[model samples]
Target: MASEPPDAAAASRRDGGRPGGLRRMLRRLTASEAEIEAEELQRDVERHGCQPARQVERGQLVSVTGRLRTVVYTPRTTVPTLEADLYDGSDVVTLVWLGRRQIAGIEPGRALTARGRVAIRDDRKVIYNPYYELEAAP
Candidate 1:
């Protein structure tokens, strides 16, 4: 007849009465599939002698290869930009093509390599007008 403690009830509610729910919740909160993949990609890039996005320093010239995670067109700006996020398993760098709406073969889910100088704009890593090459289709 006694009411359950709020903390115990909350924990049970969180994990469906399953054991290690807290651990699972912590892992889910701390890591995502994208993040895990990024970490793995980082290792692979390093193993192959390429700099990962996270290891790229400001003003450093970098050549990074990764899959395009997103491609967005900003038409409302004074100078339109075609922005794409490239994730190489370690981190993501935003590639901005100024005065562009789109480029052939530069779409999301495509593998490509971008080479440019690293810069931080608005606290996000970005590479403007990066020279890009599409990876060979598998």
Candidate 2:
């Protein structure tokens, strides 16, 4: 079999042998802090063998690991709810605990792994009363 020419080999090495290598590099260079953080979180999710939030189907039991983007307590006439948005880079899954104000260790920027059945409300993914484990602050 014929081998690659000298120029071809050099170019392949320079670009890591992939056409989109340069594009990916450029994207990484220009990515915002949040984007970079999301990418890192995604990698961590994969490393820990947890399901991604974006791929979770409604009604399916899943365990997703991510950082909490926001935590809010909403008070209603009948009950109160604590909600947090868990972002795993690909998507956000809201965790809602009904009749709760807040829980210790559940706050913004904290890492967590939550397991529950997925549900959709008002066109967003939510898990109600999920069993969650808070990760140590990094």
Query: What lDDT would each prediction earn against the true structure?
Result: 0.86, 0.92
Error of 1 at 33 (Å): 5.7
Per-residue alpha-carbon lDDT of model 2 for 1-138, expressed as tens digits? 999899677767878899876566677889998898889999989987899988998999999999999999999889899999999999999999999998999999999999999999999999999999999887
Candidate 2 versus the native: TM-score? 0.79
C-alpha TM-score for every candidate: 0.69, 0.79
Q: Tell me the lDDT of model 2 at 107.
A: 93
Clashing pairs in 1: 38-89
Q: Over 4 Å off in model 2, which ranges?
A: 1-28
Model 1 alpha-carbon miss at residue 57, Å: 1.3
